[model samples]
Every structure is written in structure tokens, then in C-alpha cells.
Target: MTASERMKMAAGEWYTCIDDELEALRVTARDAVFEHNSLPPRQRGNIAPALRTLLGAMGEGARIEAPFHCAYGFNLFLGEGVFLNAGCTILDTAPVRIGKGTLLGPNVQIYCAEHHREATGRLAGLEIAKAVTIGDNAWIGGSAVILAGVSIGEGAIVGAGAVVTRDVPANTTVIGNPARAVTPR
Candidate 1:
């Protein structure tokens, strides 16, 4: 049997995001996000339940602050002690795995999806995705953008406002638009 669009998407193959099944899933996720973002901080008791329903896997002590946005929350996995600050956005068209103790500063964006380079394909709504992985104890600074297929290694630090297009080595610090490793002090 041929693979479904969702299956193809998860496999990082080209797929159409406008599929009815996928659109339905996005709707469900959007509803959960809306509810989660609407609640006041005083109503903290209600937040966890919504996140549990939305995310694929949410580990113990994982905390995502309000105003989080994602295409499909079900594709997101958060490990123990992960903290996502406010205004975080993840285009989880494919899996986005955040390892234990990883921290994402405010306005951080993780994108697992990409459109076709060709105009014909782009106009046809053809898209592809790649899973993004962040290793344990890593710190992603505020406003950093992690692109598709990038794996951030353990203990790595991505400086503020950096755009990470490549894999980050363990225990290193990277900075700038096309992030480059900083000389260790």
C-alpha cells in the first residue's frame, strides 16, 4: 500500500500540507494552543493538561511558557527539565526532539519544514521536512532560529539572535546568522 501523506511527511519526504487529514490535525493542535495561551498565569493548574494533550511526549518538569505556537504539537517531544520561554514557535511538520535539561530562550523558533526551491513545486504546495534534535543540557539563546535537519549537540550554546543552519558540536558555542563556532575563552 502507498504511504499516507502524514507518513510521508514524518519520513521527511515531499508532501502537501493541505491534505485534509493533516489539516484536521493542525486544527486540533491549534485549539489546544489557543486554550493553553488563553489561561491566566494564576490558572497554572490547567496548563499541564493542555500540553499533555497537545505534545507527542512531555517529560517530567518540562515547562513551556505561554504564547507557544506550532503547526502540529503532536510532533514535538520534550525531555525532562526542558524549559521553553515565551513566544516560542515550532513548525513541527516533522519530529522536534528536545533533550533533557535543554533551555530555549524567548522567541526561539524551530522549523522542521521547508518549501520547494523550484517555483513550480512551490506553487504546487510541495513541501518537505526534517526532524530537529537538541541534545541534553544545551542552551538556545533568545530569538535563535533552528532550521530543518539541524542537530544541536549536548552542552552546546547558541548565542542570542543566531540562525542555526548546521549541526552544532557538543560543548561549543556558536553565534551569528549562519552560526559559527566561537573561539573558546
Candidate 2:
């Protein structure tokens, strides 16, 4: 049997992103997100019931501030005590796992989709997804951008405005574009 575009995407295989099925899913997610974002914080609590139902998994005490956005909510998993500040955006075409006690500062962006490099492929809307994992107790500073396939290790600290493109070592601190480990002064 041939795999559907969604299946191919879940398997990290290249697939055309512009598909009816995907569009419908995105629309569903948009509605959920809108509900979550539009409600008062007191009423929304940690997460709106509508948005919570849309997610794959959400541990107790997980909190997402208003203005949170994701490509597909089902691809996101949050562990206990995970806190996402306002304006966080996740292009979760693939799974995005956030471990327990992880804190993401405001405006953090996590991208799981990697568009095809060639112009023709771009025009065709071809892309592949890679899972992004953030280990327990990690702190991602404000405005950080985590690219596709990056694994942020446990207790790691990502400096503000950094662009993380590679795996971060456990308990390390990284800064700057394409994030590099910070050296002790």
C-alpha cells in the first residue's frame, strides 16, 4: 500500500506539503489555537481544553502563554512543568518533545520542517521533517531559533537570540548564531 502524504511526513520522508489533507489539518489546528489565544488567561489556565485535546501529550503543570502557535498540535509533546513564554512558534511537522521542567523564553521558534534546497523542489512544495527534542531542565533564552533535527541536552542553556543548528551537549551553555558553547572567562 502506498503511504499517504501525512504518513510520509510522519516517517520523515520528503512529501509535498501543499495537500488538501494537510490544509484541513492546519485549519483544525488554527481553530484550536485561536480559541486558546483568544480566551482570558484565567479561563485558559495552563492550556485551553480545546488546545489540550489537540495535542499528542501534555504532562501536568505544562503551561503555554498566549500567542503560542504550531503547525500541527498533535506533533507536540510536553513533559511535566514545561513552560513556554509568550510568542513561541513551533513548526511541528514532526514530533517536538519538551522534557520536564524545560523553560522556553518569549519569542522562541522551533522548526521541524526543512524545505527542499532546489528552486523546483521549493515550487513543488517538497519538504522533510525532523524531530526536535529538548531535554529536562534546559533553559532556552528569548528569541532563540532551534532548527530542524537539533537535540538540546539536559540542563543546557541556550543564550538569547541564538540560532541553534546542532546538538547541544548536556549541561552546556551556548551563545551566538549557529550556537557555540560559551567559554569560561
TM-score of 1: 0.96
Model 1: per-residue lDDT, tens digit, 45-72?
A: 4245666678999888888889888899
By summed lDDT, the worst window of 10 consecutive residues in model 1 runs over: 42-51
Report, for every candidate in turn, its global Cα lDDT versus the true structure. Answer: 0.91, 0.96
> What TM-scores do the predictions have?
0.96, 0.98
Over 4 Å off, model 2: none
lDDT of 1: 0.91
* Candidate 1 Cα misplacement greater than 4 A, ranges: none
Error of 1 at 7 (Å): 1.3
lDDT for predicted candidate 2 compared with the true structure: 0.96
